[model samples]
Target: MPSLITPVMPPGSLNASAQPTLTIDDLLVRPWLGSDAAAVARVFQEPMIQYWHLRKADSEDEAREWIEQWRLGWESESACHWAVVNADDDRLLGRVSLQSIIMVGGQAEISYWTAPESRGKGVCSRAVARVSSWALNEAGFNRIELSHSTTNIASCRIAEKTGFALEGTRRRALLHADGWHDMHLHARIGEA
Candidate 1:
């Protein structure tokens, strides 16, 4: 594993406003909006999303709570979240987030999900790569980590393609609806 090093910028430099709209190919990764609640509720219905994330919001009101949590995370400087939208029509495709942030240590964990219709199209991978690049190069994060259930081959592929080196596995680290699952840990270091 690469050592966690502090970035040049001081902690708290990355606030909500510091986040920018990032365009990668046809996808637009931007901050989440209150109006996105309905769409978010719909996406959370996906079996795969529900299985991994371990939560579901079937109503707009329930979904708004999720968005509110993301917003609060930004205000607290504890995390950053983005809505993956279609650049042309501004349709929500999925979400990408840098959670578990330790700004003083210049480190964060990456998480993402693709809409059911958007899967197998590399949407998640592209969004993840772009966001991770920005976190390392622009936001000045020294280390980024990704973790997924060991059974999720697709997520493993995304992590590998985005330059995150597989570190090891944490047995029974996450509890899904089925049971406790072992999770693989991956990490990437910023350029020197």
Candidate 2:
């Protein structure tokens, strides 16, 4: 698949041998495009991703179709989905999204999943911290929220590392493959 997350700089005008721009804070969080469908879809097939996002994406054809829908969502301002790319090789590291945006309420939630190979390397924590800071400092958001199944200890750790306060649990909030599962809700509010 072609690159989905490129530096925010003007495309098609980059200099040769340029350092790979990684993300928003040395990371480059940008949208998934047509060519990214295959790779991004493969992520969905991972067992961990399926548990969190709840879809295996089955095949590249399905991923392509999802990308089409994603284009519509982006143009309509319904979502801000981005692929996490490495600063060196520009390889996709993972994906992140600003889901359920509420303009009038000045609120949004962030969700992300790192590639299986990228787990346990502080990638998700760094991404969450950087994005949370942006939500408060750059985006002027009053609140940001994220949730995970109670069994997901790793994600809970990521929340803690990123400064997300444990708000509470919503019993039976998530219906995972194992059946109805409780979810721990977490939130971070900007200084108002």
Candidate 3:
């Protein structure tokens, strides 16, 4: 049996080329590097990051392991993660990722977080919008989805800013540290 829509992108398509660096204003979005472990670990230590993400890198080694997973995801065409950096000083600012990729279906889920210092400055939203556009227009994906806990008003605003339409909510879709959360589902689809 075949899917009604043929594979929009073949497996290994993303792996075939060097990941390109994307830009938004003064920031650059590039593939994660092993050397970024120290900065990544430091960011993971931030209380807000730990609270929202539910995981922390207590050591640089753990951060490196996470980086390695991103590398492997590229090789396997399962995900794409980029580190957002300050163009002038090369300071780490945040991250944007397309995970749970399904090439045959041309879809993926968007994930993102901004460094505490970069929050409230539109970094995450701009980075997410840029990455989502790239994924749809250049990376061969037709649909990209963003979901966040319903209580996360900031994320909801980002989704709206990035033009991801509210598709509805999934009750108790995610388990957080405190309890299960109903998640708001948003999606952006490329023009057919």
TM-score winner among the candidates?
3
Preferred candidate (TM-score higher): 1 or 3: 3
True-structure RMSD, every candidate: 3.5, 9.3, 1.2
Distance from true position, residue 42, model 2, in Å? 1.6
Whole-model lDDT for model 2 versus the true structure?
0.72
lDDT of 1 by residue, 96-161 (tens): 999999877788999999999999998999999999999999888889999999999999999999
Ranking by lDDT: 3, 1, 2
Off by over 4 Å in 3: 1-5
The TM-score measured for candidate 1 stands at 0.93
Clash pairs for candidate 3: none
lDDT of 3 by residue, 71-185 (tens): 7888889999999999888899999999999998899999999999999998998899999999999888999999999999999999999999999999989888999999999
Error of 3 at 34 (Å): 0.8
How do all models score by TM-score? 0.93, 0.81, 0.96
lDDT of 1: 0.91
For model 2, residues 1-192, the per-residue Cα lDDT tens digits are: 675644322222212222222355556666676888778777887887887766778888898888777555545444456677776666777877667765445466788899888888777888788777866776556788988889989989999999999999999987777698898999998886
Worst 10 residues of 2 by lDDT: 12-21
Residue 15 in candidate 3, Cα distance off native in Å: 0.9
Please give the CA lDDT of all the candidate structures.
0.91, 0.72, 0.93
